[model samples]
Target chain A: MLLESTEQVSRWHERRAAFAELDPSMRAEALQRQANSIRRDIVRMISAAGQGHIGGDFSVTDVLTVLFNVVLDVDPHEPRRDGRDIFILSKGHCAAALYATLASAGFFSPNELATFMKPLSDLNGHPANTKVPGVETSTGPLGHGLPVAVGAALGSRIKGAPARVVVVTGDGEMQEGSNWEALMSASHLGLDNLTLFIDRNRLQQGARTEETNALDPLDEKLAAFGLEVRVIDGHDFRQLEAAFGPSTTGKPVAIVANTIKGKGVSFIEDRVEWHHKVPSTEQVEMALEELAQ
Target chain B: MSTLLDTAPVDNRVAFAEELIELASHDDRIVAVCNDSVGSSNLVAFRERFPDRLVNVGIAEQNMVGVGAGLAAVGLIPFVCAAGPFLTGRALEQIKADVAYSQQNVILCGMSPGMAYGELGPTHHSVEDFSWLRALPGLDIVVPADAAQTRIALRQAVAEPRPTYIRIGRHKVPPVSPETNVLERGRFALAREGSDATIIAAGTEVSKALEAAEILAGRGVSVRVLNAVYIAPLDQQAIAAAARDTRAIVTAEEANVAGGLGAAVAAVVAELPKSQRVPMRILGLRDFAPTGSTDFLLDHFGLNAAGLVRAVEEVLNGD
Candidate 1:
């Protein structure tokens, strides 16, 4: 089963409540600790499974951490409970990071993490909403989540629900025309309840996004699509927390989180090959040791 | 024009818009999403009734479908309406992943399907929708025969909020067996019951099949007509019965002969014992059409009543 018991759920709620009450510095320290642990989980999971997008996973770990622990109002026990803030991992190649985060949040047992990408395991290479509790929708296709986010936000407004819809997409995924289409729709509908958090790790599967598709004027492009853009150092927990605030611009907020792929480990940082490159046993041990800090 | 064509054919889109508005009035969960196709999709009345409920995504089919799936995920019943070719062709992967694979409660409204846009050319023709959509598993693909069946399909969608795709007909068609009081779920409506030969058809082609049965009767060929409503969970029971009971089986649709209703019947019949099997004729477009009006194109491709009767006679004569 995906979710833990009701007791574990209450513990999760209590932990998030406590984290929310923490001052900025202490909250960052706590989040940094959890993000590091999630990164360690990524290293161990990839090394054992021999299949994972380690670069994007590491790059997106902190965003997932901040959203689950402090931002998103989801009940791990009731993943489909109405009025809960919906979170979608559009950049779903980074399922390792999402699985680890959801596990930490008690959406599912950490034991299931051992079955990552194995035959007949629910933890496949990409997240499946039918099998996984925390996944709002089955999203692995690039440029899918944001459009759905727009619809969710619109539906919420139509029903007068106080739910917020947040989706995280890879910066390289921004090259997809559908994202621009969704951005235009969101802006046209004036959806303040929607937030698009982009994991700008500057790398896709084959090459750096700049050298490949060149999203150099990404800020202007987002602004052109009518989103109130906020560029942030994605590694900083405080900035991650700040970028997720309610949109005061009366429009959708685009959080362009500039990050380093394979972050926290010195060797893998910004290295393009680790997009799904399996880590060696020695490399995994060294990575975990560095994350132990 | 044949007396069969004399009946004032109602565009089933009228039934679509009326039923949607009727359903939305009672249940606020019903919201319509279109790709700047509000007027063409017959959603103007819906917009007028509840302006906020109509989501026009500005000429983007991919985003329109994705948004509809998202809306459904968020506990809203979204009727994602778009032109058939664009809805099924452009955002096909979204339809596959977001709606079919995810199994969201999204109702896809493929408006004016099956060569409804005649002069506008093959690019606008949704003749390939059936072949394209039937390949997806677990999607409730329904092609309403006429106005009443159209309403029935809509109500059924709301009752069972499964991943459904309803091909809303823009081609005018007379009601099928107005006397057959109730339509069964996933079962073909046997429009005319005869023992010699059977003609199974869907959408605008159903009425043509019925008329073909009439013409066949005049020609001393006792033909049965089966109105295929549900395409995906094809009434295999009724279909196999037709194959068993009749001398021959001929499948017709306003779609390509590939993966649509005919191919569906062929697959089912291919499972039967060789002795029980009947010779079949799959009638529809084999290739893309040259420029013409809806009637000219359908007739040119032998999608009319005469075509249906000829196919039945050929199968009966083993030609």
Candidate 2:
């Protein structure tokens, strides 16, 4: 009886270790399927709610997908895990994508996606940190995430911990002078552990970024501000994975992810009207079909 | 009155720095984010002690507040110190977005609030801070009356993790509360007690309200004084009780009349029971103050003891 019990314990331990050793490639593939499902769900939710930032949502979906799936060392069950990586969505209007991603990553019930903008729901028009389990900070206004990311990075460093801080911001949101101020401080402090990803959709609320306020020399600007800049196709998962890895330079990294607004759905791609425009029933069905494929 | 030996009066800003330094000594999470106002904020010692902790983000007020919020996001207790005018006016959007809406645990220390820099003109005066900041939700607005209150408020601010704005007054103020008096949020300090009328004040005007009460007492007018430390979460209970017991109420603040302490009191009094309702007179800047010395500006704006006494008398006569 003792020998039989010993054999059973060893078998359980081997299975546990094997599950823990799952490769990143396999994890990324699982996350990709989840991301596609999340995108489909976002379209349905926005369509049902009759209001949402669809363009930015579609643009940042893949970015959030990779972070929650591959890069971040976090457990949804322990959302506030002390040693876990900190992820702040600075451009809070893109909350539809974040909410979907968090839900898929098991931060909350996937059914909660149905309550995106319902009155009195924990999920509101914007992501509120106090209400949401996975949300690190409440953000709606632009140019806020970077600084908080820097602080989180600094705090981790203060405690002599290996946890990293990542903040995703919209390119249009960077026009606010606050982002640069944070950039300067992050560089000055040499916050190598922090990574900033800009969802460069090349469009703002009213017009194209170039027409509204040109950030043509964005890479140069970030470099001048002392960050090690890396330009990537935001929707490309492989490139995002490489860019988000541990930094070598003793300075903050800015991944200028080139993205198309209203990605995945062809009709609304690069359109300004879709910034916060909820799709009709027909459009939602079409979006779901496109994401499903 | 008999002459007493006058000691060098301590500035509340120094007290603010001292308390912050003390907190930082123990808590590694305590970080100071500033807009290049180390000397002005009296954080030179704080910077020297914790060089790594002091984040001087140049002269950009908007960025300073944003960075402070960011620091708070990572589980760091950030004390964002800067000139009141620049901190509030320059970065009003950041305060609204990152600090208030985001609900970051940031201690926004508004150095030298009110018309402290009188000769510097209207642009420098933080008269609109109370109104502008009070309008935002999930933020605590603290205008400390003296050095002791400044220390207590700063300590309490860190202990209670929330978005808080501390208006550190530049104008000299005499300590009104007892040494043992613990500063509590949304609680008014009874500086003096009487029955005929009540004087409500905050920041530098608290001491002036006390002086006004003494002057009114000599003139056969029984006056009560209440020090309003937390302006946003106004001590409604104390205010309602004062309005109920007294025949008249007078509110004094070194801020604008539109949305400052006076406006807050007026809103509460309007909702009070008709039997307990009393006549109220608000004393504050009605228009852009003219350029002059700090004392001259306070007198001109009717934020002095004489102004409070006059406002109380007007309320009494009207009632």
Candidate 3:
């Protein structure tokens, strides 16, 4: 009811034609190629914008690509599809990754990524659902997306819709008490259809996350909150796909994706200063080359 | 002298609950969200009627509001009910970003607003909500004065698709406006008409302003009382008319004077031509209230009917 039916049908036709013929291996290969392309786009977006949270963006790129390309049942042309899966980037500072992945998935023209942070641009420093077609909600101040995702999951249940809610959060963003509150409710409500991906890059804006606030032993904390916790290498597309594959049981699943900050680029990976720092022209080329390889 | 207790009083919370339940019965997408405020918000009946629709986020104001925004995003109308202070003060960022800035159609029902939590102290008082929320862009702030207005406002808010904050009064108040008075967005009806001076009041203070108007009438000082239901999209025309037509203007509310109704009225009057401008007096809490009951605190802050009369007299005397 929220979306136009004609637009949805056309978009669904395109998506079905794109994926319906592909076998599982071909789909995985296509998604892997999309992830590399998204990483290159993230580098270009941050470099062109002159400032962005590239570190977390690179850290979350593969996860975003995997979800958008293969996992989430979403239509780019009809972003407001009621029965489609919902994805919220709770750690919204890494909007470059989300925007690039969404664009690569055909939500909008990939050329629009150049408008990131420009005046009157839909691609602001944070993702705004009002301006952007595919963004579920506007998020930037950290620890917001999870709760909204929880609400969406609950809403899907109430409506008896076959939609799944997925929220991607940063490891450092977990320090926000709101996420803990959401974790409590998501477990209490037994939202088996909900999945939260914590991009555990271990590096915050200022310094290492452990030095900042110490979110180690995170799996135990997640398990304590009554979630079915799984730790996976975020860069591994196969692992990411398996984790997001199916609901194991009653409780919701929280996947702690152990990812390196600035994953694809050799010089930028795991570097604290790369948090929101833009890559120089030469550095951008270097990153592109690394991703291309 | 007739006191505030003389008139038969009704709780706006009950009216809000009833109207919400009625609205939800017809619209399946209407959901009630609260942060462990089921009892305080008088949502027991709503929960009982629509158990599946009520989302209790449990002691987390931020999550509750965010969840409300998410629900709105997914095409469900979420009425986020919580105590006034916590709803406005605690989860303000979520209210600003998720609901207001995101332009989500979430109805924020601030329960027990103003000094309703009287003996519970200043921490619980939602006195600064108007000031805090009024600054946000694209958010409607509605403070319904009585039960009838509460019913009307809730029904209207449910029908319209926009982010709104309705302060439902826990304090008892007699219906001040007649059933003929139509309630709309950014419009206020004249509860009492007089040319001598104009008195504007919102929320629980409207009844007190009416009583003050009666008192002023007995003193041969005809005063017009404007019930300010919509605070954000203020009736600038009505406020400007008050300055142009009346000798003086007095703004009153059961909230902080700094950035609330008084400040809103003052801003409008200041923008008018000098000829239309008149001396204005603002009556409300200037600081946090000390320990006391709701009545005691109202008296302590000069928010009673006598307070409006005194403020009007001060503005009239031009002192």
Per-prediction TM-score, please? 0.97, 0.93, 0.95
Residue-level error in angstroms, candidate 2, position B158: 3.1
In the range B126-243, model 2's lDDT, one tens digit per residue, is 8999999989998999888888889899888878878999999878776777556787787887878889999999988888887787888889999888889888688999889998
Candidate 3: list runs displaced more than 4 Å.
A1-29, B1-7
Question: Over the stretch A134-238, how does candidate 1's per-residue lDDT look in tens digits?
Answer: 898888989998888888888888889848999999999999999989999999889989999988999999999989989978888899889999999999999
What TM value does model 3 have?
A: 0.95
Identify the runs in model 1 with alpha carbons over 4 angstroms from their true place: A1-11, B1-6, B179-181
lDDT of 1 by residue, B1-319 (tens): 2453467889999999999999999999999999889989999999999898898898999999999988898899999999999999999999988898888999999999999999999999999988888889878888888888889888878877889999999988987756235666678887888999989999999889888988988989888888888887789998789889998999988899988899999999989999788889999988998899999999998999999988998899974
Worst 10 residues of 2 chain A by lDDT: A1-10
Tens-place lDDT per residue, model 3, A236-282, is 87788889966787889999999999888899999999898888888
Candidate 3 chain B: worst 10 consecutive residues by lDDT?
B1-10
Q: Summarize candidate 3's per-residue lDDT along B1-319 as a digit string, tens digits.
A: 1443366898889888888999999999999999988898888999999999999989999999998988888889999999999999999999999988889999999999999999999999999999999999999999888888888888888778699999999988888766445687898867889899999999888888889989899999999989899998899999988888889989888999889999999998898898888888988888899999999999998899888889888879864
Pairs clashing within candidate 2 = A147-B70, A148-B70, A151-B71, A152-B74
Worst 10 residues of 2 chain B by lDDT: B1-10
**Candidate that beats the other on TM-score, 1 or 2, i.e. the better one:** 1
Model 2 DockQ, alpha carbons vs. true complex:
0.54
Ranking by lDDT: 1, 3, 2
Q: Native-vs-model 2 lDDT?
A: 0.83
In model 3 chain A, the worst 10-residue window by lDDT is A1-10
Interface RMSD of 1: 0.7
